[model samples]
Target: MADGKFMTAAEAVALIRDGDTVGLMGGGGGLMEATHLFEAVQARFLATRAPRNLTVVHALGIGDKKTKGMSCFAHEGLVKRVIGGHWVWSPAMQQLALENRIEAYILPGGVSSQLMREIGAGRPGLISHVGLGTVCDPRHGGGRMNEAAKDDLAEVLTLDGREWLRYKPFPIHVALVRASAADEDGNISFEHEAANLDAPSLALAARNSGGRVIVQVAERLPRGALKAREVRIPSAWVDAIVVDPAQRTSYDIPFDPAFSGELTGTARAQSEAADHARELAAAQEAFGERQAVARRAAVELFNTGKARPVINYGVGVPDAVAKLIAARNEQHRIYQTIEHGTYGGTLMDGVLFGYARNATAMLDAATQFDFYGGGGLDVAFLGFGELDEEGSVNVSRLGGVTVGPGGFIDIAQNARKVVFCGTLAAKGVKLATGDGRLRVLQQGAVRKLVKRVDQITFSGPQGVVRGQQVLYLTERASFRLTPEGVELFEIAPGVDLQRDVLDQMDFMPRLAAEIGVMDAMYFTAALAAH
Candidate 1:
């Protein structure tokens, strides 16, 4: 404490005590991930096994879905419990949960992020309707993933004769956050990162609980290098800083200052644009039927007469929707947003899903979720791995793998309208598109539309109760979510309704009085343009 807050990752991690509740701050694609700090903790645990049975909390899917980030803490005795906002990126942890090796509880992204802020403010708990009728709801398993999870972390209460869900807050013993730079005084700034994410709230939560805040920074600066407004985490809230000088901007790229919007001069913008174009071109090479699904989803948005619609996109095919929108020169007509707080920019996909190719402005991750939880999104395009007769969607789990809903629940539930985009089936499904018509080369072995989804990430029945217009857009067909169930609304040409649609589904959907054919133009690569 006397020499300065700067320390090596191992030295900083030594402060974490056994049985401590550690709060982690990071989003998808390794954005603002304290990799060195996490690695140091893992190394220390393996060597000494001192900090055993620690409860870990994360607000998003961090890591590369393999051996990185929180996966380091997936050892049996190191982690006793996990309260996660998303689990898709951590397969090792999910495997532990499946084996009942650790207690696992999952909550919506907005709720978890807000819970940290409430904890910082010394609030009793977080009260919100973000997870009212979903798995996080007490009536629906209370967000528990396996039998080992037993605590009732959330409860349903009545206020003013209305129901609200309150998530109980726990004491934080350590907070690990990542930033772009930090002064020797431990003043943090995320000037070069894509988003600030949960760093601010995590630090505050640790400070309020009399815990230590360990930050990972790409660069260690002099005390006065950080401007007043740029200090995202104050020195008062920070306990130590670990500097990784060679830190890359994300998992894929080494460093791109244009992402931070700080070096967005004309020359830099042009260079970034060229690189973005090459990436887009490569992604489009494998578009295949994904193009049809994305175009159909985007057409629904383009048809809407609303001027400059406020739209948000999830990863996967939804990213294609953003590409189609930009290709059509309709980017200016809609205010595009990503859950990581980037707004009005070309949306990026893959490991860099939460970032933007070019952004107009960036806000705090919690503030972005506030807009989503408060019903600020007019339309949200999201990917679906599974959908059932009841219109429930499951992108969180499949075949023993748990990819938790990063921000899917918050965006899907709060948006005025929701479009679930994906293929009708997966795993070797083949189709050919030509002359504005599709030919079914082969049907997929896995039927995405089933009697019941393996897990309910987006509760369609809940969306119906909220009076939201929900649509499932697939390559071969489309369905509109009704209060009773899903109703078949459209089908692709050159496909048999019974063989390709009805027979493949586990449960029958209510057919529209006159089933409309999907626009023929959607069946070709031209859909991306015209």
Candidate 2:
């Protein structure tokens, strides 16, 4: 059962040469990350200063914000360029981009994953409508994050008389992927992983490009130990296998059968209960403004009137909708999904946002995005960093940081109904809610409702043209997107419309002909009743 394909993490990383375009496979919070390989590369570079000026490509953000995942390549000369779906996980990398040290570019997570397959197939590139009007569009900066990023990775072209964005492909000289186990012949299985991200595509891209595909696994099994059906990457495509017995399912979690879809039914329920208890204890003030916004957004799930609607919730306040739905015992009435491909489970928050506890099913990231791009989602609730007078939203490239839109563009552009959840003002906003009324204790200095957004992540005008339902939900008010712009139709109880709602915005929104007061239940502990 022995072969030269098996090696230590350092030996596997040593195969990477200088100036190679290395592809990494993982999602947020180090899910499925080849941690040992990344550590080896970082250590090797620090010790020998080899593999300098490399180009790093990742379909999703992979890090814990402090020091892991992409942050390992934060050194000035370690990486010359970066192309990723999201960037907030590694602040050090973001600083490199901010300082114009590295050529940084962002693309939608779905586009990046699918583009990998296109590269593997030796196709021209990915030509899709996923980012026709967003920042990825060539006309809209072409996904460049800084002046150092000079090349246009995306281009706008008309296909069949319809506009589409073509995300150019690049050769992946080295692909670093992770799985639960690898057989003696190098076949890989992700049986213990929470989600199978773009690992297969990355491996294929590397192999088809005549490059090396290095995979890190927790354990190594004898030949034929893994079933043919369980092997995600065939031995023929993998070049090196690194065994790290200490590999974890996620950064914060050592191991959880529910995350791998091995445990379900009553066991799953108990796991979800434990997670809810932990989150509730950690966020006792969750009943404040953010929860109120989530409460209103949750109502939209039922308003769709579908017997069982398929929905997605973005990170931040939008995640609260899942908790509210669980509180109402309405989990069975809707199918909740995450962009990273888990469905029907208690969605995790913070660094664990991509994985779900007790998920009923886990699809690979690309297949899930296919459903989303085809308008399979009945509704998608997303958090917004800025809302403009034209009803456009800006979640990417905000606050002087280049946090790319992971799946926000793919979900928002394709969902039948999109609800944006956030506070009217962001920094230092304080609110008190009780007895069916909300009081703004202190206003935030930053106004999220602006006349113009710094960048457009979701084009409201394009959404209106597509006839999609778009609504903005906040603690103080709710607005519906219209051809004329944002129309304020609902106001929170005990809030002065002019002082609390209008004054907080950089631009005035058109008032509805018959504005209504938000239901009092949203402001109180009886939110589940509604």
Give the local distance difference test score of model 1: 0.84
Q: Which candidate comes out best when scored by TM-score?
A: 2
The predictions' CA RMSDs to the true structure, in order, are 1.8, 1.9
Q: Which lDDT tens digits does candidate 1 get at residues 213-245?
A: 998899989879989998998999999888898
The best candidate by lDDT is: 2
- Expressed as tens digits, the lDDT of each residue in 1-530 for candidate 2 is 32579988888899999999999988878799999999999999999999899999988888999899999989988899999889999999999999999999988999988898999999999988888777888788788989999988888888788887888988999999999998888889989999998888889899999999999999999988999999998999999998999899888778989889888679876887886665555444446777778778887998887999999999889988877776555788988898888898777788888888778888888889999998899999999999999899998889878999998999999999999998899788888886799888888999999999898899988898899999999999999999999999999999999889999999999999999999898888644334
Candidate 2 local Cα displacement, residue 279, angstroms: 7.3
Which TM-score value belongs to model 2? 0.97
Give the runs in model 1 whose Cα sits over 4 Å from its true position. Answer: 268-272, 279-287
Model 2 local distance difference test score: 0.88
The pairs that clash in candidate 1 are 88-403, 88-404
Q: What are the Cα lDDT values of the candidates? A: 0.84, 0.88
